[model samples]
Target: MALRPAPVGTGIVFTRIDQGNALLPAAYDLVSETRLGTTLRNGDGVGLAAVEHLMAALWGCEIDNLFVDIDGPEVPAMDGSAAPFVFLMECAGVVEQGASRQAVRVCRSVEVIDGDKRIALTPADDFSVDLLIDFDNPMIARQSSCFHGGSFAFKTEISRARTFGFENEVAALHAAGFALGGSLENAVVVGEDRVLNEGGLRYDNEFVRHKTLDCVGDLYLAGAPLLAHVDAHCSGHGLNNAVLRALFASDRNWKLEPVMSALPSWSETAVAAEA
Candidate 1:
């Protein structure tokens, strides 16, 4: 797959070369499914699955327009993190377009809840995330992350975090043809008493950090980058998409704003890539 430059207002589009070159938009309204990951389907039913990691990387890098040429059904689950996708964007290098980037400035707080899980977005002068997770397993008891910086912080503190699953769940996932490409090499598998990975962890609480990374990708489905503080607990892809729908339904909930200076690191990195 390759990322090609697109004109302003193009948003993110995925073209399937094998599927008669069908195009699908990476927008919330185009989201046809959100099982374990986000799937975008066009009216003709041409689909792309598990795009969150790539989308998250694009959001972190402040990339607003692009054409993704893919020969397969889904983006490769490279190492189960956004870091690889970040690397792809950096190598391609980003250039400023004639128009300023747009962001959805939250005006009213929006919340979505499903039993014990919940997610909310509140108006803020800057973007941030507050995430919390708790599991029944002793190995991954409770973890929380609060991130307050932009691109650089995401790469250093959140990007390297890999997706994780339980040993008991892996067989079931593969049986269902869900994680056929998943392995200990791409995901951190946890046993009852310890992690199965040889390297232990990239961070002490990598599980929650990966969840925060997913949240970043999920929220970008709003069709533009967000300029609000987010708070989430025990929420996954389902609840994330629900919250975005609710936020977009209410007109007073958000407004568009010109890009600010918070994303200088991505711009600077792009320059370094071309040197």
Candidate 2:
């Protein structure tokens, strides 16, 4: 993957080089489904999988314009989290153009609920997140956390947090032909009594941290950076995508901001590039 500069107002677009560099807009209208993970499909049959981690990294870093090129069906699950993506962006470098940044400022509260899961977006001065997770397994009982704007706290604390699954689910996953690339190195696995992966648990509360990480990524589908306080509980890609769809379904829910009076301050290295 490469983080190439994009024209202002282009938002974030993913290009599949294997398919003639076809472009897929990263928007709610293009979201096809959230089976094992979020998938975006374009009219031209171009699609990409597991985009939430990368999206979260970009949003957390306050990158308003970018072009991502990939040559596979799935973004490389590099180290099973967003840390590698962050490192790659750091290496490729970020550039600021003459144009300012635009964001989708939430004007009202929007929410979606399914059984015990819920996701809500509320008006806020800047992007923020509060998340909680509860699982029956002892290894991951309950965990929670919150993040304020431009914290990028998620990068060091949660970005490398791997996706997890149960041992019992593996048989069914393989039967369904999923998790073909999953392993202890790429994911955290839990048994009924303990974590199956060696050297278990990067953080005792890693479960919730990963969930918070996913929210940051999924909410980026709003088509721009957002100024909303999001709260979620035990929500996955499906619920996150549903909340975005609901937000887009009604004009009363949200509106686009075309002008940006300020751009986020780039790092010293990135600032030099802009100069």
Report, for every candidate in turn, its global Cα lDDT versus the true structure: 0.85, 0.77
1-275: candidate 2 lDDT, tens digit per residue: 66677776677888998899989877867888787777889998789988888887776666767778889897777766777777777666666656556667788899999999999999986778889888888788888888764735766786878778888897678889977755677778788898888898888887887888888888888888777899999889999999888888888888777544444443211211221
How many clashes in each candidate?
0, 0
lDDT of 1 by residue, 82-146 (tens): 99988878877877666667788999999999999999999998789999999999988999999
> Positional deviation of 33 in candidate 2, in angstroms?
1.6
Model 1: runs farther than 4 Å from truth? 174-182, 260-275
Each model's TM-score, in the order given? Answer: 0.92, 0.89
In terms of lDDT, the best-performing candidate is: 1
* Residue 221 lDDT, candidate 1, scale 0-100: 86
